[model samples]
Target chain A: MKKFLWYFSVTLLAIIFMFPFVWMLLTALKEPGTALVLSLPKKLTLYNFKKVLFEFGFSRFFLNSLIVALSSATVSTLFASLAAFAFAKKSFFMKEYLFWLFIASMMVPGLLYVIPQFLIVYKLGWINTYWGMIVPHLANVFGLFLITQFMRQVPDSLLESARIDGASEFKIWWRIMVPLAFPIVATVFLLNFQFHWSNFLWQLIVAQSEEMYTVPVGLAMFKSAHEEAYTLEMAASSVSIVPISLLFIFAQRYFIEGITQGAVKG
Target chain B: MKKGVRDNINAYSFILPFAFIYMVFLFLPFIYSIYLSFNQVTDFSDVFGGLSFVGLKNYLFLFRDKEFWWALVVTLYYALIIIPLNIVVSLLLAILLRKRYRLNSMYRTFFFLPFVLDAFVVGIVWTFIYAGRYGLLVNILKPLIGGIYETGFLGNAKTVMPSVALAMTLKGAGFGMILYIAALDGIPKEVYEAAELDGATGLKKLWYITLPLIQPVTTFMVIIGIIGALSAFAEFYAMTGGGPIVYKWGTPLGMTKVTGLYLFNHFSNLRLGLAAATSFVLLVLALGLSITYSKIQRKR
Candidate 1:
């Protein structure tokens, strides 16, 4: 009886969790007015998805999102890791001050800075460009803080042994620390990808042309179109949702571990 | 001294990229925003002009702006409503899933799917669900609530904010559940075992033991909840585009145009100075709230 109840609740929760995606799929398959009912379609078709991807240029937007997410993750991780190393290993004047400043910046509501950041992007003539999105985000305080905490856990003896073998600091970091920190690197990459991929306001502010629009901004614009085109909008929504959900499926362990670590060390 | 200087140089090189970008982008922009808040400029082109300085006028204007105050009230209302709603529902769900259960990981992944979703995507999906006419909700309510047939949840002034809040609350509660589940796992089993020895079970054990233990995690969730509610932009932008008009249930976004959305609009139109001023206002509000909340937490 207990087992049966458990299974029932599990199935129910899963259904509830997947209701929207199922709705999106059903909506996409339907001829417009048919979707107005919650019932399943008697027919299935791929027209809405095709129209969104081919006719509406969703493919370009997806590619743009992929490029931005990948580039931001790679560049920001590299810079953040290097900064994290400095904070973890070195004792210098204002080191504590700098670290604290960065930590404080993490808590600063991002909305407050969105406008200022846009202004900076404008002044640099980077509006509607890749560099505008990528540059400001390169200094990720959370990434820096997380990496620094993880790097501090590395045994100093390992680094000393490498030094005794005449390894340079860079070499030590590249060879020893980098491999040991793979879990964190993966976490940071996934988190950053999740953040940058779903970033809307930034993309909305900086990306002028439809060609440059990322998925979130693209989805926003798509939803804002004439109200009657709900089928196509749902199709576009599913396209964005599927990839990120797949990403989480693959990286759920790391994402959970990262948040747990943040709480423990925080 | 020379050797120390060499180490300093190496450190500087290590920190250079972060420092340079932060100073140029974040720090400088922050200062410039404060300056812009004091000056008046009509457009982006006029930003560099020698415009007359108007001290505290923008802020004063914001104070008198009924829409801004309404936005503030609505925002607080939304935060107050959603925070407890998420905490209670997530905590209960976390407890339900905490025991030995088949398909546990599967259930977790499914529940957490929404947090990973783009808010814009969720907005699109929920818009369909909440559509005024021919929407799933309307279809369901047509037979039951006759008057509700014509009234879309988001389309109606009375229901718009609450309906949006409900959607967000549903989407967000899942994430809080994940966090609480993680926290719940750390709670030592002995505490429960001890409670059982005293013949406490169910609600009694939960209130006396479990709630106290998870207080820290609950605090963290509350802070993040407030920030999340206040910083909410994508869903509102995607769903309502601010609003049809500020209703009784209107959000800050509906009433005064949230700073984030306003920033996007103003900057897109090339009104950079006013955008900057608006940013400063947002910054002050956020800072003030954070400090107030931190103080409240510290006292607790």
Candidate 2:
């Protein structure tokens, strides 16, 4: 009886957590007029999704988000690993001070950088461009810290052996350190990807043109502009969530590991 | 000696890419923001042109700005509510799911699922759930609880902040749960076994053994939660737009406008100087909390 009660409560909690997403999907599938009603749709249809994708030009936004997130994550991770390798295995002047400087920067509220970064991006004539969206965010201090923490645990003997083999520093990082630190590297990449994918404020500020709008920006605009279009809003929200949700489900281990590792150790 | 020099050269080469970007984008902008805070930029479009120095004017203006104080209060209230609520919910979930069960992993996945979502998307879905007439909550409760929820949770001044905080708490609890689960896993089994042997069972065991063991995680969560609450923006932007405007002392304040949103509002209005000042205030608050956290960690 006790075990049954436990299962029951857990299941109830699960239902509570899952309800909003379920409702969103259901409303998206419903006809426009029926979206507000809670009952099952009388005739489920793909009308809302189709409209959002084509008529609202969400496909373009979706593509923009993908390109931005992918490039940002890849470049951010690559640079972070290079710096992490230096911080972890190599001896450099002021290495400790530099690493601490990076760590301290993380504590400063991100809002402080917004006005200045925007001006800098504008000065570079990157407004309404992917460069504006991606460049400012590439120097990810948190990613650097995370990768540095992981790479520090990497055995130094392996690097010494690679050095003895006359491997160049770049080749050593690419061939040895990367493969060995692949899990954490992948974790940093995935975290960065997720961050850029849903990053709204920066994208909103930079992507002034409709074509450059990412998923979150487009959805926010869509919701506000079409306030009465409940079905369409639901569809757009669904589009914004589905890709990340699918990715999370498939690679949940990395997501969980990355989050916990960062919090616990840092 | 030459090898040492060569090693230093290689290290600097490796660090140069990130350091260059960091210097130009992050470090430089950070310094520039301070400079911007002291000067009034005449044009939003051309921040570099027509800049007039107005030392401490922005900061002084914010000192008397009731709207800014209200945002700080809302942010503090949000932090107070969300930190405790999230810790309780997440700690409970972690404790409950700690023991191996038939569907434990599935239950964990279900709870953690929401954390993976964008706050904007979650906020939008929640707005519908809290919609006035035909919202799921209203429709479900109208017959039982009656018209109180008619304006919906996000539609009222009294309830709007807590309502948004609740949505955020649900979205965030999974993260805390993950942390707690890891912390709980680290607690040696012998401690629990010894407690059981001493006739401490059930809640007694939990209060005495489990709670103390997870205090570090609690502290971590509290600090992180406080920082997260202070910097909260996307949810307010998406759900309320810091709305259901309430008037106090003849001033209109957004009921949900925390410091992050307040900063964004200033920036949007092209009040660049004020925005930078607001950010500095937020930075001090965040840094203070982080310092307190580190102090606590060191004490242990």
Candidate 3:
């Protein structure tokens, strides 16, 4: 009886948690102007998806988001890894002070940087461009912290052996440190990817033109513009969510590890 | 000494790329924002060209602005509700799911799935769920209850903030759950066995042994929750657009206009100095809470 009660509650909570996504998919499949009901649609169709992707120009937004998220994630991860390797492995002047300064900056609220960052980006003629969407965020202090933490645990002897082989510092980082730290590096990559994928406010501010809007900004604009079109709106929402959901499903381990490690250790 | 010098050169070369970007983007902007807060810029196109020294005028104006005060209240209200709801729900779920079950991983996945979603996406979906007449929740509850939910949760002034808080809590609870679960797993089996040897049973064990052990995670959650509440913008922007205006003291104010949204609105309207001032207020609040958090941690 106790086991039965436990199973019942867990299943109930799961259903409650999943209901919104299920409702979204069902609504997207339903025809436009249909009554909003709890029951599943009698006839499922892809018309709404097609309309959102093709007619509403969500495909363009999708591509833009892909470019920005992928580029930002890859670049940030690479930069963070290089910097983390130096901090973790090398001897340098003011190294501890420099790293602590980076960590301290993380405590300052990100909101404080937005206005000034916008001005800087605008001055550099990056507004309405991919650089505007991606450049300002590449510093990624949290990513640096995560990678540095992981790299410190890497055996120094391995790097020392490589150095004995006359491998330069750049090659040691590229060929030795990065491959050995692949797990944490991947975690940072996925975290950064997810951040840029759903990054709404910064993208909304920087991408002034409709043409440059990423998925989150585009979907927001789409919803406000097409408020009454519930079916199409659900389709747009699903389009924005599904790819990332699929990524999460496949890379569940990294995502979970990254989130837990990021919070717990910090 | 020579090798140490070479090490410094090698390290600087590696660190230079990230350092340069950090200096240009983050460090410079931080200083510039503090400067901009004290100066008024009249032109969007030419921010520097139109600058005038306003000293403390912007900060003084925020102190006198009713909307600013209301935004702060709404932000506090949001934190008050969301922090507890998130902590309780996530803690409960973590304790329950801590041990293995028939479908434990599936249950974990279902709960954590929403965390992967963008806040904007969750907001839009919940907006539909809370829509009047045609909303899913309204339709489900109408036959069982009444038409009281016709305007739905987001449509009314009184219910809007709580409704937004509920939606955000549900979306974010998964994150806290993961943290709590990890912390729970870290507790030794001996701790529970010792508690059971004492007169402690289920709830008593949870209160005496479990909660105390998980206090650090709870503290972490609260600090993160406070910061999240202060900086919360996307959900409000998506769900309420910071509105469903309510009249108080003969002045119209947005029912859900938290500080982050207020800052965004000001920045959007080209009120640069005021927006910077609002951000500074948020920054100070966040830093103050963090300091208090660290102080408490140290005391414990």
Candidate 4:
């Protein structure tokens, strides 16, 4: 009986939480008129999906978001790990001060930097270019911080032994730290990818060319194009979510782990 | 001195990428924005040389602007309403799910689903749900619930901000829930077991033990929540176009507009200096709140 009630409440909460996604799915499948109303689809069809995917150049936007997200994720992770190794393993005069400054930057709201970042990009003549979108994000503070914490856990003796054998710090970082830090690397990649993919404001600002727009910008434009085309819009929304949802489902354990790692300590 | 300097050079080499990119892209831009904010320039084509000093007029004028104040109020109101509600709801959900049951992971994923979703997608999806005339509520729940059929929740001046707030709450609650769950997991089981032996159960144990122990995480979440609310632009842009009826909402748009959107608007309008000024103000506000929060957290 206790177990039964537990299951019942869990199910109810799950429904409350998952209702919007389900509603989106149902809306995507229903006819336009039916979607506007609260009724369930009498019969599901692929028409809305076909319209959004084939007719609307959503495929190009998806590819753009994917390319930008992946490029930024990969490059940022590498840069963060390299910097984190120095902070973790090296002893220098200004190490503490530099690390603190890096961490301080993380506390600032991202939007705070968006304007300056835009101006900088414009000055460099990198606006609407992939480099403008990807470069600023490549030196992520949170990623560096996460990796630094993780690196600090690895015993100094291992690195010392490699050093004694005439291996450079860079070699030790490349060979030993990178391999051992796989879990965190994956964690950082997934988290960063998710954030970059979902980021809209910067994309909307920098991506002036239609060909350069990410999925979110494209979807926003699509929605505005046909305010009354509710089913098609919902279908576009669903399509946009599918990739990120799948990515999250696969790596949720690590994603949640990475988030909590810092939350608890602070 | 030579050997020590060599080590410094090596260490700096490792950190070179961070310093170079962050300096060029972030720090330099930040400084430039401050410079831009103090200037007035009419033409974008002459950005570097054309700017003339404007003093505190931009800020003084900002204080007098009604739209700016409204945006500030609405932003704060959304933060005040949603942050506490989110913290409370997430804590309750975390505690409720503390006991082991089947499909707990599924429940966790369900809650987290909306957050991973694109904000534009959430905005679009909820727009339909909150539609005035032909929304799902009217067609399905209106007859039974009986009063929601007449109003467009997102279109109304009174309801637009709150309606958007609730959507943000729903999309955001899962993240808070995840953080709470992590804190809950870290609490030693024996602490709860001890509380149970003292005849304390349910909300009593939660009130006495759980709340105080999780205060750090709660504080962190609240700080982040306020910053998130203050900086909110994407959802407002996607859902409300920054206005239902143009009453201030306490968002960053009050002084600067969304730097991103402002830049887009003025990219062709030749008003780069004004846009840059707006950006600088937003950055300062964000940094000010973050510094205050950090100090408070440290003192605690």
Best by TM-score: 3
Instruction: Give DockQ per model, in order.
Output: 0.65, 0.82, 0.80, 0.66
Instruction: For candidate 2, give the lDDT.
Output: 0.88
lDDT of 3 by residue, B184-288 (tens): 999999988987888799999888899889898998888988899999999998999988888985799998899988999899988888899889888899879
Interface root-mean-square deviation (Å) of every model: 2.0, 1.0, 1.2, 2.1
- What is the interface RMSD, in angstroms, for predicted model 2? 1.0
Model 2, range A34-78, lDDT digits (tens) per residue?
Answer: 876668999999999999999999999999999999999999999
Q: How close is candidate 2 to the true structure, as a TM-score?
A: 0.97
Residue A82, candidate 2: alpha-carbon lDDT: 95
Alpha-carbon DockQ of candidate 2:
0.82
Worst 10 residues of 3 chain B by lDDT: B140-149
Candidate 4, residues A1-266: lDDT per residue as tens digits? 98898888878877877788888899899976777556789999989988877788777788889999999999888988989898988888889988887787776656546666876777789889898888888888888888888998999999889989999878999999998987887888888898899888788878988888888898888877887888888788888888899989988988888888767654
Which ten residues in a row are the worst by lDDT in model 1 chain B?
B249-258
The CAPRI class of candidate 4 is: medium
> Which of the two, 1 or 3, has more lDDT?
3
Indicate the docking level reached by candidate 3.
medium
How do the residues B219-292 of candidate 4 rate in per-residue lDDT, one tens digit apiece? 78877876777667777777777555442344334222333334345444655556565555655776677678
| Error in Å for residue A46 of model 1 | 2.0
How high is the DockQ of candidate 4? 0.66
The order of the candidates by DockQ, greatest first, is 2, 3, 4, 1
